[model samples]
Target: MPNINILTVDDSVSMRLLLRAALTKEGHQINEAEDGVAAAEWLEHHQPDLVITDINMPRMDGFGLIEHIRAQPRFRDMPILVLTTESTAEKKARARAAGATGWIVKPFDPDQLNSVIRRVAH
Candidate 1:
């Protein structure tokens, strides 16, 4: 697969680190953000191939970020994957409604994550 640039957002420092290590190992460029607010700032200056964000974050939850990104014409079709612990059908439906391209529950496997990124990164 070609090199993919990924922006990963999560409130946990540990989770971000893990994702960084894993995705970097897969040869993808990763930009880490502690929350939606930080991710939004990064998004304004840089456009990644995909966004992997977690819900229930402070400052601006994943849902808010998805809506914000979707509102901007430039990012309307960008692929966004909700990488959170919430697995309820309701949450999934809401994420889809907000323009998420896919969903991956937390505690994600490194291989699966990389595979999913490849699939959605296009």
Candidate 2:
């Protein structure tokens, strides 16, 4: 697999650590953000190969973050994977509508998580 840079945005500290450990071990560099606002700020300063974010967060949610990224010409085609505990069909649809490339429910298998990252990362 290519050594891609990844930005993981989640309000939960545990979730971020889980991702960092899992993804970094798979040879991807990880950047973390506590919320959508922080994610956006990180994006402004760094361009990553892929972004994995949580749907439920303070300040701004995943959908809002997607919209913000999509509205920007530079990030319009960027790949985003929603990695959250939300498994509702409606919420998944909303994420798709907001320009998410895919969804991965939390407590995900380590291999499965890596697969999702590989599929979306350029």
Candidate 3:
């Protein structure tokens, strides 16, 4: 597997910690942000191999972040996995339309998270 750098954006500190731990255990270097705005700021200085963001966040939501990333030429093709408590079909549809590479419903399982990352991080 390649050495992966992942940026995880979520408002919940515990969620971010959990994701960081899981990803780190899988040998990924993880960068964390409390919200989409912070994630965007971090992206300005660093480009991670992948982005994993929560759909619900203060300042900017996952869809907004996806739009922001897509608007940037440098990050246009960056893979993004949206994590959300929302499992509605409409929500998933919106996510796909926003250019998210995949979706992970909240309270994600560590093994499943790793699997998704490995599958999407190419």
Candidate 4:
């Protein structure tokens, strides 16, 4: 698979580190953000091939970030995957409505995560 640039947003430092390690091993460049607010700031200057984010965060949540990204013409079609511990159908629907391309629960499998990234980003 071709290397892709990814912006990963999560409040948990450990989760961010784990994602960084896993994605880096798959040859994807990753930019980390502590929350949706930080991710939005980063998005102002950079464009990534895909975005993976956790829903529950301070300042701004994943839904807000997704809406923000979609509001921008340049990022409207960018693949956004929600990675959160919340697994309710209502939450998933809300995420989809907010323009998330896919959803993955937390404690994600590295192989599966990479596979999903490939499927959506490419």
Pairs of residues at least 3 apart in sequence or in different chains that clash in candidate 3: none
Q: How do the residues 8-44 of candidate 4 rate in per-residue lDDT, one tens digit apiece?
A: 9999999999999999999999999999899999999
- The CA lDDT of each predicted structure is 0.92, 0.90, 0.90, 0.95
lDDT of 3: 0.90
Worst 10 residues of 2 by lDDT: 113-122
Off by over 4 Å in 4: none
- Model 4 — which ten-residue stretch has the worst lDDT? 113-122
> Residue 70 CA error for candidate 1 (Å)?
0.7
Query: Residue 8 deviation, candidate 1, in Å?
Result: 0.5
How does candidate 2 fare on TM-score?
0.96
Measured with C-alpha atoms, the lDDT of residue 11 in candidate 2 is: 97
- lDDT of predicted model 1: 0.92
On lDDT, the leading prediction is 4
Candidate 3 deviant stretches above 4 angstroms: none
Q: Write model 3 residue lDDT over 1-122, tens digit each, in one string.
A: 78799999999999988898898998899899988899999999998999998998989999999989888898877899999899999989998998899988977899998998888887
Clashes of each: 0, 0, 0, 0
Itemize residue pairs with steric clashes in candidate 4: none
**Clash number for candidate 3:** 0
Looking at model 2, residue 36 earns an lDDT score of: 94
